[model samples]
Target chain A: MTQEVEMKEAQAPPSNSFSSASTPSTLQHLKEIASLIETGAYAKEVRRIVRAVRLTIMLRRKLKAATALAFINFALVQGSEAHAKLSAYLPKEDEHDMDVDTASSASQGFAKHALPEIEIYCYLLVLIFLIDQKRYDEAKACSSASIARLKNINRRTVDVLASRLYFYYSYSHELTNSLDEIRGNLLALHRMATLRRDELGQETLLNLLLRNYLHYNLYDQAEKLRSKAPRFEAHSNQQFCRYLFYLGKIRTIQLEYTDAKESLLQAARKAPVAARGFRIQCNKWAVIVRLLLGEIPERTVFMQKGMQKALTPYFELTNAVRIGDLELFKTVAEKFSSTFSSDRTNNLIVRLRHNVIRTGLRNISISYSRISLSDVAKKLRLDSSNPVADAESIVAKAIRDGAIDATIDHASRWMLSKETGDIYSTNEPQIAFHSRIAFCLNMHNEAVKALRFPPNSHKEKESAEKRRERQQQEQELAKHIAEDDDDDF
Target chain B: MDPRLVEVTQIFGRFKASLLRNDFVTSSNLLSQLKVLLTKFPSLPPSFQRTANAYEELQIAREIYEHAVLLSVKTEDQDAFERDFFQLKPFYADLKGLIPLSPQEYPILGLNLLRLLVQNRIAEFHTELELLSSDALENPCIKHAVELEQSFMEGAYNRVLSARQTVPHETYVYFMDLLAKTVRDEIAGCSEKAYDYLSIADAKTVLMFSSDQDLSNYVTEEHPEWEIKNGCVFFQKAKDSQPCKEIPSLHLINQTLSYARELERIV
Candidate 1:
């Protein structure tokens, strides 16, 4: 599915590319260099590689036009080393002559004329590098300056680039908790995308807007936007993964766990191999949703490659639930309490406490035919002393939930399990089964409703108009052809 | 003086007065306005040669938000408290060495942590814990919450209940009351299974209800099946109202007799 999306994206109008002057050989060398770095082979000859790339850029002055492309590749491979080199070449923001011509002259590039487009590319690369280094403050400044430059130029071609830059700028604000600034930027971007009828841009902006809303715990706003946001066909794996992940999160927050689980599972499956972080996050939410729906996640979920360490806390949590040990569940919850809270699954985990107790009661009922309520309380660790009242309530709740098969004998102060034959004939099991089926059916209906596509009224109107115009044009062509035929005759 | 500084001061003054008077509505409105003003201020504040002035302004803003959080708690508006707490969180987490935090910061931070615990947001509880300095962690207000959480998780209900008395701050009482209720409810559940009947006095003592009316109301609301008559709370209603399944003793005897006959025939 992801491959299909990628194919469609490749066929669509490209949003951003390296450069018009990019050569296949340069890209190949870049890839080779990246591989060398990945394999640690470039460590010993790092300086030599840097010098060689610099020399090549200098010899082929035309290559200087795509300097941002090379620098971006270099940053990916060289890490901090590229940051230092790029910083040395980057023009200071406050400098009056901080333009492409001045930067080209200062860097000793043989190209007499400097392309403003290349300057924008360089600014974007630098912005990316700064953000990658966790210098969000500097990245914000760089993005703002780049955006200001873009606005000064007012070039129609750079609108896409400006939108991308604005996303980073707003992202920095989000990280800093400048809520109003982030909201303002997103609203402005939303308006721009609407004006241009840029479906892909609207989709991207909507995802960011939804994220902002969720970040601030603005569920009402998020719900309002989800119902109204422009729906666009997701043509990239990253976009599709994001779209599904956001949908799943919103559904989870609304307690629509079944639909959440499906969307989250699809997101995890469609996520790129390189985006393992995103995939892991999706799985974490999926695991929580499944747990909420009274389904035990398989042990294999915790053991997936690259996910073991990140999932260890959840694995222990699942184990505690599986063993029906309330104390162990509590211990595990406390031990990894930070992990659950940070993942925003703490509320769901709290709900699991009742499940743990129910499971414990079930195990207890199976083991003993008749036990005093106080003894059951002691075994279940309900209270330290005089737990008779607490134990009775726990047992009563357990029996009500159908977690245990037993009867409370008030006079004898004992819980008695039904004889084997009597247990089978009771209507309780049937009721439980019916409720489970009902819940499943309800979830299925909700998912189907959620997955239903919105009516594409605008698209339909556009197509209908286009068809009429084409019919008129065809009739005119037919008349012209008949006139020409008469002349030939 | 910068005109913005005067505006910030006037706003802060009004916020402080509103908070003192317990006017949460006005205080929250002031906070929103302050937040907008702060958002518009350049983060790095280019005019300031050093970051000291900017950091001081940020600290003041943080304190105001902290007051807003307290006000939310006082008003029993949990959602507002959560929003205010998060709004203050970034300032605490990001401005590590720029300025010294007020003495009230740790207590407020601890109160926030306890709120998360009561809400069962353990993950976020730990996330907040991870952000505190070692010294802050050792502070009594913070340690109080950490200990309560430990006891609760360990099934030491007694300790959890006892910790309520030692709650470090006035605001801590709200969350403490919530935690106390949760603990009592868990005990109530266990008690219902453990006993057939308890005298009204014993029920009150066991459930930690201070008044007879409170215990009676609790029983009436939570356990309608429990009959409260003759000064005792009966966990189960009269036998006739209870569902009973008859034991098939005759079937068991017949099976035994058939087995013996089969043995005799084989011999």
Candidate 2:
């Protein structure tokens, strides 16, 4: 019985294969070997097939089998001491319907199943750790080592290996502003996702690729992928929710507000109740949809709720249109500062808020038409960290890019270049963006023209008061003229 | 005393008495009073200011009132009510400014604004109902008390379809189908529940914008060749375009009402 049990242990597969065709001849030979042992004879045919098939098997699986054999041999060499660590590592009996977090944890050590790949995975793992630590240089170095190690392996083409390479490359360029590397990595991911035959793998890869495109503002590429994404019905509820959310965001960015609202509502309705993080993400998307739809007051309410739920700081900073409450925005900014502990994210949030507040102040110019550009700038400067200093930095950057002429045109609508005349007349966002820059530079007249309608002094109540004052001055001048006529008489 | 508050109080007194008697003059006078209250520094009550939901509802109500005031063309004593409702006009302007005017909203806004005024009327009816219930139905100032009672019941049914939690599918199918049939057949011989059938058709215009699918076929086919536009799903005339074939009669309404129950079972 002990011998039979030992023989059974020797034949167990090192890795699971859902496809029976991938099962090795070693297993078939082991079956014959067991029968031969029962009959007390060597099976020559079984031995031949095993040796021939073993030669064609990849080196990674060979190393895995060899390591496993060495571990089994160690039991004989040291009385189970070598097997002890291996035995304890017997994977926790995996639950089939494991949630995402638990599933990631369960698969954390899956690379160990392939001994050769373990070395490559270890390097990538260390790089991920370095990236998490914000040591981008160290992470890039580790990523280089990982890619080099992968080139050395020269194994059968694995899609996971390709994805990891691009993933690492993408993150390495994130801090360096290396657009070429970033675009290359994203394109690679896009290709890999498209070429992948595995349904689940394709879906997940597409999800990642879509998000990367969105982050880089490559809307055209993202839209092409979005059009091809399968309708979300019949997917796992969690995956369905994510698919709907992405679809909704894509539509929202394209200004298809009504369609986006329907998709987002479906996502919020169906998102997993247990995952607070995902629920908050759905809420954040809703807030974003509302913002795009120009429901400013409602957006403000939703953003505050989103902030309380710790959804994201982006919503808090982006929604500067409704400055009915500033303390709320400030509180959210402070929360983001502590949560991220990254000065980049903190500074980005602060800059976004300052721009929003400035836009709000500019709106006052659009509405009542009394506030001067300098007065608004002074208020913004006092409220903000340093308004003038920031504006100068932007101007310097523009000058360096040789875009000062373009910047000046943005300030004054009347001074629009002949080339820009047609484009500036129709595109509101473009005009606003340039006008915003001009306003920041204190080109008041240019900013006013960029506005929806330049403030008509004749139309305003204050303009009426000005006209009355002018009439009084005119009457005084007439009286003076009459007095001069009497003196002549 | 704040002049606006005193005005509101005086309007409240007259409005309360009229509302008790189901008096239009009283409510119309109260509109002026309500207008004064609305025009005060804070539009809604102080308590509403503290809560987001209340603030939103007040804003919506304020919008409806203002839209009705804009659409008010009749020259009457109730013009004061229109004037009072005018105080709420800024909310509508704000809405118009914020929400880019889609072609669809032009008709729906007018209708919804009308519905908003009707809702205020319903509120006054409720107050009258409460006052009358304190003793008996023969309360002074309530002429055509039976008709008023019937209208109030119809209004209650309206609430079910209008509320947020309302099953939109059911409102579209069963309630609407029943209404169309009752109005088309002029089924005065049927049960009192049949009276609810006609109002459901009138309510469709309000719901038309809410649904993503084109529902015009349901109306056009039923009336055969009728094109209903301007948030008017019910037609007064046959369509100028080619007439669609008449819609098949079915128990679709009953099926719709059961859809929620079916979903509950499956889920």
lDDT of 1 at A280: 80
Best by TM-score: 1
Best candidate according to lDDT: 1
Docking class of 1: incorrect
Span of 10 residues, lowest total lDDT, candidate 2 chain B? B187-196
Model 2's alpha-carbon lDDT is: 0.40
Model 1 RMSD in angstroms: 16.1
| DockQ values, each candidate | 0.08, 0.00
Q: List the residue pairs that clash in candidate 2.
A: A411-A446, B174-B253, B179-B197, B225-B239, B226-B239
Error of 2 at A126 (Å): 1.2
> How many clashing pairs per prediction, in order?
23, 5
